[model samples]
Target chain A: MQQVFGNKKAIAVFVLPTLILFIVVGFLPIVQSVYYSLLEWDGFGKGKFVGFALYQDLFVNDTYGIKFLNSVWNTFYLAILSVCVQLPFAFFLAHVLARGIKGEKFYRTFFFIPVTISSAVIGLLFLSVLNPNYGVLNIVLDQLGLGSWKHDWLTEDKTALSSIFLPAVWQWVGYYMLLMYAAIKGISEDLFEAAKIDGASGWRMTFSIVIPLIAPIIKVCVIFAVIGSLKFFDLTFIMTNGAPQPATDVPSTLMYNAIFRRNMYGYGSVMAVFMVLECLLVYFALQRLFRSREEEVAR
Target chain B: MISALRTKWSNVVLQFFLIAFAVVQLYPLVWLVLTSFKTNLEITGSNVIGLPSKWMFENYKYVWVGSDLARNFANSLWYTAITVVASGLLASMVSYAVTRMKWKLSKLVLLIIMSGLMIPVHATLLPLFIILRDVHLLNTPWALIVPYTVNAIPTAMFILVGFFSALPRELEEASVVDGCSIYQVFFRIMLPLVKPALVSISIFTFLSAWNELMFANTFINKSSLMTITVAINSLRGLHTTEYGPIAAGMVIATLPTILMYIFLSDKVQKSIVAGAIKG
Candidate 1:
């Protein structure tokens, strides 16, 4: 039985299809993206090799006036908000719900409904609600005597990017909440019982016991939020399509426009490559940051 | 007495907060449903938040029958179905091999597959587009199918591996000692034991494939081959200010998953949590 199961051929047969597909569809494309980033081509014609000029143009030149750096900044801006605002809100909800609140199941399901729905649908839902002319938001604001605060949420450059962040944060707070809630639920009840017997205040108990124990899951949620923000495309694409002079452009949308719209495959590939590297760098930095803090806590 | 009063007050406040937050979370969807039933005049009226004075069901009929939504719906259904089954089976096999089978390179193989999770789909668009064009699958459902299955493998495997690793070894050993072949042991004995994980992975994959927009938008240009997402996106482009049919289109696109979540919320939540912690 061991011999048959351990046969080299059997192992290859089982594992190779997925591995090959992963390489072909996942790994090779990334390597090819890097290679393509180094060339000048229209994606169909014969390419001429230009060394790192595209990367420099991405940073320095405004030849296309696409604001590559602005898109990068926008992506990071969303990532920061995700980490700061979304994570805390999610964590707070999870922390509260983990106390075995009544109708916890109902609340959990209700909150996560948005997560299951497609981003495109959510984008449309919000677009209708935020439309400048007939949007419910501006109408409500007028009734509440806050009409001065209303503007073209998706059109005007001042509010377009910030407007998108609301839906972005809305869609996923419940998702991260569920993650942290699950982690918190896994904590042993005995610790809470002991803390109660010791007369620990509820706030103190949560701050010290619950928060510390769920720190690892919190890190996971942070990484998810950061990466999710970096790759945020669907909502922005469907909602605004990077309109009003690229005000709400993220890297993924920028990459899409470059390749598909402008036929600048090399420039698009550079954005893709940059996204991959940024994700890796942020992931490792997060790991190191969390690991060092864990060590400090242990000491 | 003061402490007890404080507890009661806090509980009321907390409940209010939770309920309020839930309202904020769900109001947009409720508004969407209501607006879908309203006339364009009603939607564009000064009273944007009011119930439709007359619920018009024609918007739904227009969206369902007037457009290519029905065909696109079929495309989304079949694409998601194929992706879920193929990816689930492949991922389960690889997971079983990596977790149970004693192979020297199992860890490396697992690493290679799992690393696919980090590569954003956008990064692969250009080359994928070119490859599909070369293979004459640019407008075919296969373009979406192949990438969907490939990209879904990591998350599916991540869930399956945890389940596979936790399965008791005695059952496999007993089956083997009874002259059952390795294939029989796997197919007949092992696969059923991990049904829960497989179900969760299928749900996750189905939701993702159903919601997939970028690939569908990029690869499939013809209205005949467009998924519901891409189809609805086109609908948006054509009917930019036509709120009723547009809202109806979104409801059509979103209803299946929303209903699925309603029934299988537990399994979905468990899968998400398990995938997060384990992956």
Candidate 2:
């Protein structure tokens, strides 16, 4: 069996092409990014080794540092809202839908619709929906006799950040809901029956029974939400291009402008490196935090 | 009786909330489709949320004829097709080798490949630009296809490996004993067994490659080679306030995905779950 299954030529034929492609296209660029992050150069021509000055500018220079840090903060803000606001709402929906209501599948089918559509389309959809003069939002506000509530959603600094992010956050609520719904559904009916017999209400079952049972999956969702927030680009680019630069800019958009627009390749690579590290750091830190909590629960 | 009444009332509220939330999730696509049919005047004036007074079929005609969107749509279809097929085939081969075939470095190779999931694709953009430029592949469709297919490998393998690992060893062994070669057993037997996994992963790969924007935008400078997302963006650039035509282009770009979901919601949902599991 080993001889037949492990034909050397066959294994090479099966694996080598994918391995080489992954290395060249997927892995090599990451290594090159790390190398470029250490230099000071435009995208074209020769690059000079600058020994982390580019990275220092991201942290210490007034113009670059301020914008970069603000971008980082905005990205973190997204993660915070996704966990605090979006996930909880998804949980609520998943909890209600898990109770075997009529049209449960019907509701779920619609809820997941936005997830299938492109972020570009979603961005454009929200762009028009928030188009100030003719937008549905302002028109509705007017109909409700609250004309003062209307503002240029994507143009104003105050609303632009939150407004652009609303669609991004909204797109994935169904996703996390579906994940948590599946996790909650995996809980045995006997446990729920026991809770109900003890006179525990639906809210009580949710807090005491469902939350604890699905804690691991919830932790995974939180991590996913955070890392995904750190990588957000398309919608931000489409809606505003991080206009009012440091105000609404997230990391990817900032990096895009730095490298692609301004030819600041080295500084841009610093942002890129920072993003990759940020994702990894958050992922491991969350794992450690979740693991420790699990241990505490065991005790 | 009073407790039962409380339960029934709460259920009604819950149902109402679910319906409202579903409408919120679904309303924008509804709006986009409706906005596509309206004239610019109707869209901007009296009918932001109602049926168009004059349904303008010209918007679709404009997108289909007036711009390079038709050519761009063809490019998108061609690129997405190749990506789906290539990623599917390559992922299956790798998954089979690692899970079924005995190899010394299989585990290590799988680890390196799966790690690609964590490395955000955007981080590689600068370096990829340099690499592709040096190789003279910057403006070609291969620029997007190569990276898209490669980026997809990790998620595809993550799905396929589980299915491949679950097949009983004796099934393959029996085929081997019948004098079938390893290649034949893999291609003729094992591959067929994992067709369901292949279908789900292919759907996911198709959706992602179709909707990809940044790489398509940055790598392919020529408008002729641009995908629908880039084309639509350029269209938006050229016609800033022509919401009717822009909306029509968006509708055309999103129609395939929406239609596919209507037909295969279960498969789409399952594939999304499979993709998210990698996270």
DockQ of 2: 0.78
Using DockQ as the measure, the top candidate is 2
Q: Give fnat for candidates 1, 2 and onward, in order.
A: 0.75, 0.77
Model 2, runs deviating above 4 Å: A63-66
TM-score for each predicted model, relative to the true structure: 0.98, 0.98
Question: Where is model 1 more than 4 Å wrong at Cα?
Answer: none
For candidate 1, report its TM-score. 0.98
Native-referenced Cα lDDT, model 2 = 0.89
Q: Each candidate's interface RMSD, rounded to one decimal?
A: 1.3, 1.2
The lDDT for every candidate, in the order shown, is 0.89, 0.89
On the 0 to 100 scale, the lDDT of residue B221 in model 2 is 79
Tens-place lDDT per residue, model 2, A1-299, is: 77888799999999999999999888888888899999889876889999888877788874554467888899899999999999999998888788788898998888988888889988888988899989888998999999999999888889889998899888999899988888888899999999889999878898999998989889979998999899989999998888866678888988888898899898889889989898989999999999998898889
Docking class of 1: medium
**C-alpha RMSD for every candidate:** 1.3, 1.3
Per-candidate DockQ values are 0.76, 0.78
